[model samples]
Target: MVVEYEDSLEESSYSAAAHEPQDTARLAINASRQDDLADIIFLANNRRVTDMVASMPHPFTLEDAKALVKRSEAGHMGNTLFAIRMKNTGRFIGAIGYAPSMEDGGACHLGYWIGEPFWGQGYATEAAHAMVDFAFSDGGISTLTASCHVNNPASRRVLEKCGFQFREQSKMRMSGNSGLVNVDRFSLTRSTWKALKAWGQAA
Candidate 1:
């Protein structure tokens, strides 16, 4: 179901930020909003977060955050971007989503991140699970693929926990940071996801 917020942010659609709703769950995924500008900037501006994701720009700014919302809202046929929020506090911690293939392949790449401070707390795993469930159930995608820098063990664990099997190894171009880095690839097909869910529900 699509959720909506009143967007207390009064400035131009891209001018400022808003207050996240308060709840008690560990994490929740929802559409990015104009009011989330400050949190996105505060959490994503760190080098620790920026260095891991390929497309993210370093020294991330409010304008960068604004641009992201615009791009995500533009709506690719099979792509979606979501905000990872702390349920109890309504704070934006990071982002996650699938980017559709330009070739119209029945697959898309999964990507996600959580703030440095929020790491090691299982938030990434929870967010990834929600995204995977959505991709296969509502999104109607056949396959989900993801990659992690060989150096990033934390990310590798998250993808593995989400049921992505090791596919291969490849090199990825880092956005702001120049050199290419070796990345471990992983994928989860719809049939596998259904089997796993069946076992999960049975258990």
Candidate 2:
């Protein structure tokens, strides 16, 4: 089914974070809507959660969610964005999306975040796998990149499972924490993903 959401976001500014899940939590990713504001605020209100993402505003508020939904509903030209939800219950877990990165020579960057309560269930991996598969299969994206705080091993594992290769380590000012932090970057090329698929190294 074609995904649905009401918000539009800047590809350059859609935000970033680490999201993962266990092998059994099959998540259904879809577009973000205004109605999700309450859910978003409730789950994203934690300081610990915000500290790890690069773009999420700490004290994530109703206004923020409103603006996100309003702008996102308006539209972003080349970005494919969405919210992550439980497949069966349609419960909101977090968010995931891709935006074209001009500095990366037009490669799309993959980003996602799952609620703390939902972590370790492979939901992040499931969402990433779904997004990566769609981006290549239907969106025509050739390359995808991602990053996580150097301290976040589970987040890195999510990318590894999806076939992203670790590229480098760097430091950046994290928006959520308002501080500079170390991070590890990774990337996956369309060719590599296809090869992995053929060899069954990735799903």
Candidate that scores best on TM-score: 1
Write down the lDDT of every candidate, Cα atoms only.
0.74, 0.71
Point out the worst 10-residue segment of candidate 2 by lDDT: 1-10
Q: List, residue by residue over 1-203, the lDDT tens digit for candidate 1.
A: 11211331212311212112212247777778898898889988998888889888888988999987776566443566778888877788988888864322546999898999899998888788767766665334679888888989999999988889998898888774766889898899877876776656556
**RMSD to truth, every model:** 8.8, 8.0
**Lowest summed lDDT window (length 10), candidate 1:** 13-22
TM-score for predicted model 1 compared with the true structure? 0.83
At residue 166, candidate 2 shows an lDDT of 95
Candidate 1 deviation (Cα RMSD):
8.8
Q: Can you give the TM-score per candidate against the true fold?
A: 0.83, 0.81
Task: Output the TM-score of candidate 2.
Answer: 0.81
